[model samples]
Target: MAKPPARLAASPASVTPPLGAKPVPFLAAVGLGLALRFLVPIPAGITVQAWTLLSIFVSTIAGLVLEPLPVGAWAFLSVSTAIATKTLTFPAAFCAFTNDVIWLIVVSFFFARGFEKTGLGQRVATLFVKLFGKSTLGLAYGLSVAEALIAPAMPSTTARAGGIFMPIINSLSLSAGSKPNDPSRKKLGAFLVQSQLQGSVNSSAMFLTAAAQNLLCMKLAAEMGASIVPALCGLLLTPLLMYKLFPPEIKDTPEAPKLADERLVAMGPMSRDERIMLGTMAAAVCLWVAGDMLGISAVTTAMLGLCVLLGSGVLQWRECLAYPAAWDTLFWFAVLVGMSGQLNNLGVITHFASQVGNQLVAANLGWPAVFGLLNVAYYALHYMFASQTAHVGALYSAFLAMMLATGVPPVIAALSLGFMSNLFGSITHFGSGQAAVYYGAGYLTLKEVFSYGALMSVVNLTLWGVVGGAWWKVLGLF
Candidate 1:
């Protein structure tokens, strides 16, 4: 089973929601689904078991949206509900944990936690800035490239952008006479923050371990016998797009090199942990990219790398156990995968797919025509979601099924939906964890962030969808 999409928006400062935010709408959503299960007529070819699972799935999604409980809690309940109703047994409910996808992400999280504890994340960023901070545009791309370099080792964009890039970017903004309330605010601060936000998401999409949700999508694609196309199409174009879209007042940033040099010198040489982290990540990525040819799965290589880190004292076992976000992701992703797998086995997904096919046929839509419409609808759904992972978890699988119904191949559906999951973060400040941190920096007002976010969404989609998609087609991804 593929993993559940993770905390695509786990922020550095984990803010709790208001308790008084009513659960009434959530309850209504679940109740309405329950009514549909009994009142609505099931078409002839569908099984009662499948229809029941669909109702439960709908109610579960409502609970996820309403958040009367945390996302993980809803996942737990959904799996338990399947068991209680004999939709699946306990082993079936728990089987997703045994799958390779779940463990790959689990180990990836441990590797990331090592980066946080060892100060290795900062070292990577500072090194890139020191080498590339010769000009304003160059410095911005430097930061972007730095994020991309370390993205393979870190799963949390919030942790990557918020924990590492946010502070560094803020200081860089101030040093360039671009403080929040000053007249020079527009000079570099806004551009820097926007650059960070856009850069993080695109880089996150480049590698499987770059973002938590990427791994989930990878699993789904692999399960469908589809390739994820480990190509650099997005990376090749995203920086150029940012260079064109986000221009600053100043060009030659002579002061930036001096600032970065001073900071690098003050920090001194890499610590033992940082050295180990750099080496471990380098080896891990090589294996991940070539593992299939070498007869080693990505999960096997990742787990071995993690064991080396732990045994070498770079990351302690207790620290890995205590990492809450990783644990949260494990619980939710595992259960959600189990539930989704069970639903597919029970024919609920097939029935749902057939229904969608009928509707598209009625509308006289061809496969490609329906696909473009669905892509836009999928991207637009990001407005209702605060976390990219949540949006992916709630919609990705079912919608991918619908894409299949359009007579499109699974690989096409998988890549399209997977790419959209990360790009959705570019649409709103609240759309992703990194977006939240960048927006909170005060360089851009809410309206400005949102407006620019919307603009960048179009730019990113065009580059990725048109340019990147053409490249993937060359690789036979479609």
Candidate 2:
């Protein structure tokens, strides 16, 4: 007799949330804006228009945090409200779309897509594993090195860690009998997962082009008369720091190199497309590193590289148009940047900074003490943030303003806050997209995530705060 038809599992809900929006957070955000607009008295030397803009900006930030609607939607609505209320002219509200930094980031996303399409990113990771997978610690370092190498070209941390490296890690773990949710998990899987996540975080901190928000931080810093140079101290120290903090159960993995070797052999050789991508990336990096001295802007360098890809047919125009993340970023990024610039123009940020600085100045603390306290607070505050870009957008400028008002050096204050923007992602599973990806892999327990994340925050703060301070001083950055 034939068996009865089997029952099918239900389909999961769509990844995209519906447009109808959640009510509680929505009401709370709108209420906060209205309360601030009506209840709070305007401070001395601030106009009603500036105060109104501040209320709208605050509401938008709250909406971003509560996420009653998609971030882009919130940004769009905020801009629209600003125009309708006559707080800003249409041209003034849309001016940031012409920003060079915005285009640099958008084009860099296309560069990242080239890395993904041509498989160069995967090849780089596989080669590193094959070269350094003889021991568990060695394997960790290998992955860190690969992440640092590709990070400048790949702006999306999730794409770099989750899409490229995680697959290799999963395969290696299983090959060595370390399956998730089983007795053998601790043997190799958990350690590799944690190590890669930490490594990616540090790599993101090391370069300006490594992450989208780093560019945002750069643009904001420039507005405050500070120039942020990429710092190498974090990248050099992160892997070893993580190893000491979170030691793996399996100390040695004799089969790891062999496994990596098999994968590399199967990948055969670099294709023509990868070669083109590599040359384009190399040219772009060289230009970016020396562009200022060579009279070329970073944006021009990125555009030049992107044009090469398009001209050579390495990436089609159609593919570039289809990249949702790049376009999505361009839209919301321009809106937030324009609004933030207007706030600065209207003197809201400066006024807010001076008021806070006056109180902190009364404490009679040294600049170093003030910076240390502010830095720690800034790092800890990431607990309340889910997106690094949003956190930087909302707080980085204000924090830098306060630091400057208290007599902190421009480069030091700017670079410190910028690096912490990436480092603090290690503090929580939802702190950033990459963190969510690693946590969701199920190799780590909740206790492990929090404990290790907290410890790493301390280590990262000390490393960047003390050692990085000394390094920057030596380089005359201060």
Candidate 3:
């Protein structure tokens, strides 16, 4: 037999060979999981069928966290395994894509493609720059306003923040005589970069169609039969509060406004494409906001808007596929939603909730008190998570289930968890999908982003808990 190459003593300790998995960590995780599965006793009414399904769900979730493969791949594996093991029929396994909410996400992404392909997103951002780009702070607010304006039409926060806004903001920074790693960075670039990143989070939280994860949370909430109305109040209040709390140290700047004005003059009037897109966007938002009363679902409204954009020749079929984020989101998100729905069907959510519920009852906790604790803990836990989608996948269903089991209103639990998913995005530099784009600009240091994020997280959460509670009380969320 040919002699096997000797495995080099695994480095001088911490370092390991590249281009492969870390066997120790992967083995540890899988072994720990196996131990839990075979050793732990099952409770009454929770069958081995439930156990198998839960194991598949958890293993895929671990695959998500460890990231041994891409998230979409893991999601695919979750569904495929469920079918292969007969834990779910083929129809049930693939049923998530057929969900109305899943279509809402897909159609929302098509709108995003329209926004990008039509140059409407850039045109709108420039208008904000022209109007409010008078001072550095004004420019900041303008960018915030621009983001919020386009948020309803674009569901991917990364697409909105990274693809649409970052290019504009980057140029603004360069034009204002600011360069990355240069001493002049703090003059205008640093402040704008940080403010806009925060603003992106605000906008993402504000609209249901603002972020991919937001749609995912909504779909999961709907699966649990929960309404998302309470989230609206928190979303509405985030932008202004972020501006007030995280004000730039360099408050006044004449250069930013001048630069914005020059850019506006160069761009000239809105093109035919921009005008049509604006009208289409307005119609979509009107229908979305009035959906419940009109008996027209949000998904229907989005599809209608997308069709007009395509039919009007403003957006082409090839252009829709060209935007990779939209397609990537549609595929991965559909699978995740399906897996979540399957787990719920298998009694996984109820079983997990009952376990947590028993602990709360044993501790003599009331709903109001527990509610506050849960929200705070949920927000704080973001420190341990890097991806909002991963965080939602792991905790949202369980947390919502536990809250529901505790006699909390489904709306209260659903909206709090849903909004908090975005709120937590403000707590770390790596908190959300778009965090890296802003952080990589080299304007703000990691420590600055983290500290500022932490401070503002508390502020936003308090605003929601205190002011939002009052708003909800007035609206009878109680």
Best by lDDT: 2
Candidate 3 Cα errors over 4 Å, as ranges: 1-33, 132-254, 365-478
- What RMSD does model 1 have? 11.7
lDDT of 2 at 53: 90
Error of 1 at 163 (Å): 15
Query: Candidate 1 lDDT, tens digit per residue, 263-348?
Result: 77887988998898778877866766566468876678778888889889998889888866557666765675566666667665
Counted clashes in each candidate structure: 0, 0, 0
lDDT of 1 at 28: 69
- Best by TM-score, which number? 2
Ten contiguous residues with the weakest lDDT in model 3: 222-231
For each of the candidates, the C-alpha root-mean-square deviation to the true structure, in angstroms, is 11.7, 8.1, 9.4
Give the Cα lDDT of each candidate: 0.67, 0.73, 0.64
Candidate 1's displacement at residue 86, Å, is 2.5
TM-score of candidate 3 relative to the true fold: 0.61
Clashing pairs in 3: none
Candidate 1: clashing residue pairs, number: 0
What TM-score, over all chains together, does every model reach? 0.60, 0.64, 0.61
Candidate 1: list runs displaced more than 4 Å. Answer: 1-22, 131-257, 358-478
